[model samples]
Target: MINYICNKWKAIKRAKNILKNKNKIPPYLKKNSFEEELNYKLWSTKGARFSASHRNHTLNKLSSKSIGYLSAYLIIIGIVNLYDINLLGIKILNNQVGFISTAFSVLILLFSQLESSENFSLKSERYHNCSLDIAELYTRARFIKNFTINPITKQSELLQISIDYDAILKKYENHLPIDYLQFQLTKPEYFGLNFIKIKWIWLKYYIKVYAIYHILIFGPLLTLFYIAYLK
Candidate 1:
């Protein structure tokens, strides 16, 4: 029983040592070091890409909702103006309809102004470009790590990788901040699924966006037209 306990204690110590070693940063990657900078650039680029995607999706949803509501409000005003429409045999006055529609329109206009101020789509594209640049550098580094066998050749390759990393960073200096949720959402597994599944999932996402936007914007207009024609 003593031997068994000793063996278990030793095993636990070994496991802890392995974990500690794995978590330790190499001397070459110490603060302000070339390798550390390279790693930071890679991670920063990845985070910016993910944050931009999150922002893009959020702005798109907001824009769609605003447009949809604005269209519905406008259609209501148009129908009221053009036809003698009433709600359950009670006529709504033109002044009241105008006031309500104008209020909603003003609210939507304010919301739209806020959305336009951010210009998330343009930022998303910029981040995407930066990510591509960093990805190319990262791929080169990986290739060197994988293929270079001789110690001298490996050192030469690492030097080249550092140079390339610095050049890419200088060329694309702008970076976007990333939140934790965005970082998690944009991980490799998020978009690295099989090609068919990716296509199908994206297709469904786009379809849903389209359907909701069009239905909200056009549904009321179509209904108003149908009602006008019947009268």
Candidate 2:
């Protein structure tokens, strides 16, 4: 049992090499042999990589959709503002108010969507980590069971399995392994800082301009109406 556990630990250590190799192979695992250990390592590494990449791609697609909707909103606002509605005066006040209201709604929607998407991405990373922990546990258990009962080898195998399983379990318990999935999920500084910074600058500008528009168009109009007795 102990010898088998040691073998599994060695197998996992060796599997990390597969990531760099273009032609990664499962360490051809055979009892008490190097080949068998390598095959196990290879499969585990590949599975992790595939899972991470797939999740990241899905997140990218979702973010792109949000960006698309935001772009359309800006375009519509641009078109509406181009019309010479102001020259018509008080009659256009109601429509101008409606446009401002719509812009506020879109701003709120954008903030909510970004928050939700980021939360979902973080959850996916957590799920990936849990899956990895389970896989390591299963691998260690398999090694302990295989080497314990098999009559194929010497007492060394039992000792090796014990050491390997202990090492693997300790490694997992300590959370010593760095999860690339988590790293990938962390939002890029460029996206959060640069992209969002630009978006928000424009949004702030829009809000400022709209505030001015209200003061310019409505404040004086109401004053004039009151003077003329239309309050």
Candidate 3:
């Protein structure tokens, strides 16, 4: 068992070339030469579509959050200006209330326009539905794989499904590489992602999704801390 685990770890290190070629295949992989192409298509596309679907949905949600945070910052600045406790407005912003408000307003406007143009909500729904269609084909293929004993008939049916897979992909946007990386993280048995790789992927996902917002939200706070205490 120890030896088995070690070999799995070693094989997992070469995971980048898992489906691209038949190199150091681990013991756990059950590759059916008959259904290899079909299986690979359905699985890979499904993962990509699902990952992209979630990513877009999160982006739509984040758009609202971006606006909300910026708006809140503006509101706080206004409220602070109404009183004498305007640390951000006084120290950080140099009490330029009019300019600050105008700049924030413009930023908000531009971002809202961008959010509308991107239409992440609609895109999220599209990828979600697309993923479902591909998942249906994948599940059907799995059923055939298990129950169908005749190699010839299975191959013929899977071939048709493979053709349909290409058509479906053509109808929708292909997911980014980052999306596929996220999917691989979700399937440990298949990808064998270790702790470091998983953390790296998680960091990449956060950066991809929320880096802008984090900078927007935290940048001011960090500056405030420096001026208020660290300085």
Candidate 4:
């Protein structure tokens, strides 16, 4: 009973338009955005039960509370770092534990920033909604179908023609927005900064500590050697 005005050809054209620009769709269709609904359908539609795919599809949201916690931690650590770096100076602060702690803390903060760049649940929600939206649009577009064709070789059928949603599911199964976020999180090397690339973000903290430890153990010896050399 539901025939669409915008049938297969029109839908395909719309998709092409979106793919071409990756921005806002044309003005006429802008009011009811297809992307949001399409994402919903994508998430709701079930797919393979493989561990990797299953894991990838799971919805996860980052709480604002978690952001607050990280922010507070960074602030506290930064204050300590500034206190040592400014008041004590790195050389004098070597005698204290502040220098090492500051370095470790800053590295951790930067790494945390990289991790929080993308929100998982938010992106997944968009992808899931967009899929369903497109399907609904297609269904509606059928209602407006005004073309006619022969039964045997129908070039233009009723708007109720079925879409291969299952095919869409299969194609985008693993490339969901959440999957992109997961990829971003796991691929730290793709990001910048020397420590993260070298896998030393965590170890750098200990390196700082070791340097401080050496400074403490050898400070006196170095001072003596300096005086002896001067003599």
| lDDT by residue for model 1 (1-231), tens | 999999999999999998887646543355656545665556656576655555566657757676767767877676866797774444668887788678767867876787688676776676667677777777776676678788788678778877876776676435433332335444536434566755665565445335545665566558656666676
Scored by lDDT, model 2 comes in at 0.48
lDDT values, one for every candidate? 0.64, 0.48, 0.82, 0.43
Residue lDDT tens for model 2, 75-159: 5444556663432243335576477557756764765576565554555555455446546644654565466565545345544
Per-candidate clashes, comma-separated: 0, 24, 0, 33
Global Cα lDDT for candidate 4: 0.43
* TM-score against truth, every candidate: 0.52, 0.31, 0.79, 0.28
Ranking by lDDT: 3, 1, 2, 4
Worst 10 residues of 4 by lDDT: 43-52
| Highest TM-score model number | 3
Name the regions of candidate 1 deviating beyond 4 angstroms: 1-44, 47-51, 61-65, 81-92, 166-180, 186-231
Candidate 1 — worst ten consecutive residues by lDDT sum?
Answer: 173-182
Candidate whose lDDT is highest: 3
- Model 2 weakest lDDT span, ten residues long: 172-181
Root-mean-square deviation per candidate: 8.5, 18.6, 7.9, 18.0
1 versus 4: better TM-score goes to? 1
